[model samples]
Target: MCWFSGLIALSMLVGMSSPSSAQSTAEPAKGRWTSLFNGKNLDGWVMKLKGSDLGENYKDTFRVEDGVIRVSYDKYEKFNGEFGHLFFHQPFSKYKLRIEYRFVGEQCPGGPGWAYRNSGVMIHSQKPETMSKDQEFPVSIEVQFLGGAERGTRPTGNVCTPGTHIVMDGKLITQHCNDSKSPTLRGDQWVTIEVEAHGNGTIKHFVNGELVIQYEKPQLDPDDRDAAKLLKANNGEKALSGGYIALQAETAPVEFRKIEIMPLDD
Candidate 1:
């Protein structure tokens, strides 16, 4: 090739590889945070409610509106312990999930009093298809979210295990719920929460960047009827290393504005 033509091609190639140009077109790294909720529709999520078939969105309970995922029961006469969940399509073994949510409106009629303004994000959860027709919750580690009460402190970022167990402070925890050291968030104010799940390793919860709760070794409960079936499927494997993510619809109305995750492994 002529010297002038070679020089022109080299310059064009260099321009295409320039930092500014690359930055504009480059995709995020494999471990970078990604949005789970697209803010406009439920394209990659599945809904499951107790006593209902998979993908059954009873009473339009889970919907995307106004650029957020809203868990509402405006069409229901009573909650009736529907206990719904919206599961993400993909499953992950190690990652950090961040979400911004706010409790809004009021609990549905006949909803449990203790579940007022309460919902959760379940990690390392059993698949939605594995749940019993009447299962209230899946076998997983719940990063519980709760709004403050009228007269007392109602801490958020707590941990709840349903049909599962965890070890905290090196001791096996058999309790249903474990409280965190986070301060109460009152009213309909938005709260940013983060959960870091490291497969079968330790998991940590953070409220507005403050680490509040930490636990380890989430495993299936052989005594739980539904979890026992899961155990049998895995040849009695108890340690939950990888599973789908799900958002709870536990009677109260809540709005999740953002749901994002950053994978830690391939």
Candidate 2:
């Protein structure tokens, strides 16, 4: 009888210890993965810049369907109007942003004179409410995603700082330029782009798991009008410490999927 009682107590003790043991031994979840898109609706996204209304009325430019956020030109008869931007609701200072995008369909009329059929992912972006009604686009660092038809057919990850500048290897790369090597996968295939942004103003751009571009301390050029505006809005600072993230709607139809972000702590 004593043996039976001992066994019962031992079983209960072992059962109780099981959860605590698992709690202590279980591995931690890998990297902080967060879904930027809800896959059901644009819950944490906002539309800004030249559509109609103050972003709420530009339904044709940005829309969600079939678990993807698509930037389309179906509603635009011509792309003569101002450019458009779709910004995430939250601001992230340092993190890895991974996005999958593919180009589809033809360019519309008045579409950037043949050089603007492409779209981009704008990082370190300023608030949209701070700009004037006639503002074409935000003054932010643009990770320019180009298609095959762009000027040099450089289907790679490039940089275009509208109201921003960056220091690379002790010199200033103030102008719009492609990366030293093209990191783009050509054709209509979907490409996975990853950007690792360090809070200290350093960033790395990756394409299909390969590092393509790296830079640090992006500031605004003194002579550029957009840079000046950004500086003024942010208390005369040349570079943004951190800001919002946006997807562009140029003149062509583009589709985005698997848009995810993971926050990193220093």
Candidate 3:
């Protein structure tokens, strides 16, 4: 996915919400880390699956088990490309987000080859309710997660744009995904991925406390069908500053824990 050479820069910062029809949020004290996942239940999250409404956890794809949010596909007899997302729902602006995730088990039958051991955390995303019923992915900046396979390099902590674009050196990155400098972490090992996001100012990715990819100015790509609608809705504005946080479930199974964040002052 190493197709982009330049990063992006923007200055628009806005927070949005629409969580299970209740736009509730918590005011985390600045400099204090607040847990996003309680390790008990899906108390503050909302589910969105392809071909389903905004609140359906299709086939129970995302569940809390043994104090971790596990993305599983055991109930499905086969894969149907029904991608899903578990949104924290609350909109956040400047913050340092932390997530420990690990890929496990095998890919679901009939799953796409590209999705093997692949998932992501979607930041600055569109509201779930605004998504089309058949929309495969929301317009967001994806902190792509990938587990190593038997072949060549497969770097995690990468960036993938779904309906968005990023800039660096004053040029828009036209590719869909960009590789990070992190080494391949093979096997089912716990990997800590941290993101320091300054609303729409700048976002940097860290793998195991080491910075791997840094970029700025994340904005909506006007060329994308979904993003174009969003630009129209926002009066043609494309600079994305803030929105919901989402956990992506592509066909592979993964687990997340220690989901926390510390609000950053503007």
Name the top lDDT candidate. Answer: 3
Residues 55-110, candidate 1: write the lDDT tens digits.
88899999989999999989999778899998886666788999999999989999
Angstrom error of the Cα, residue 226, model 3: value is 0.6
Kindly report which residue pairs in candidate 1 clash with one another. none
lDDT of 3 by residue, 1-266 (tens): 01011111111222243354342235566898888877878878898899998788899999999999999999999999799999886767689999999999999999999999999999988777778999999999999999999989999999999999998667789799999999999899999999999877789999999999988888888899988877766766777777778999999999998889898986
Candidate 1 — worst ten consecutive residues by lDDT sum?
13-22
Give each model a TM-score.
0.88, 0.82, 0.91
Segments of candidate 1 deviating more than 4 angstroms: 1-29
> Residue 190 CA error for candidate 2 (Å)?
0.8
Alpha-carbon runs more than 4 Å astray in model 2: 1-30, 114-117, 150-152
RMSD of candidate 2 to true structure, Å: 15.2
> How far does residue 246 in candidate 1 sit from its true spot (Å)?
0.6
lDDT of 2 by residue, 1-266 (tens): 11111222333211111111111111212377666776766666667766444556363778888878888777776667757888776556678989998888887678865454478899877665554566777767788787775335465677778866787887888666656355445567888888898754688888788888888886656687755754544445465556668898877788888777887774
Predicted structure 3: lDDT = 0.84
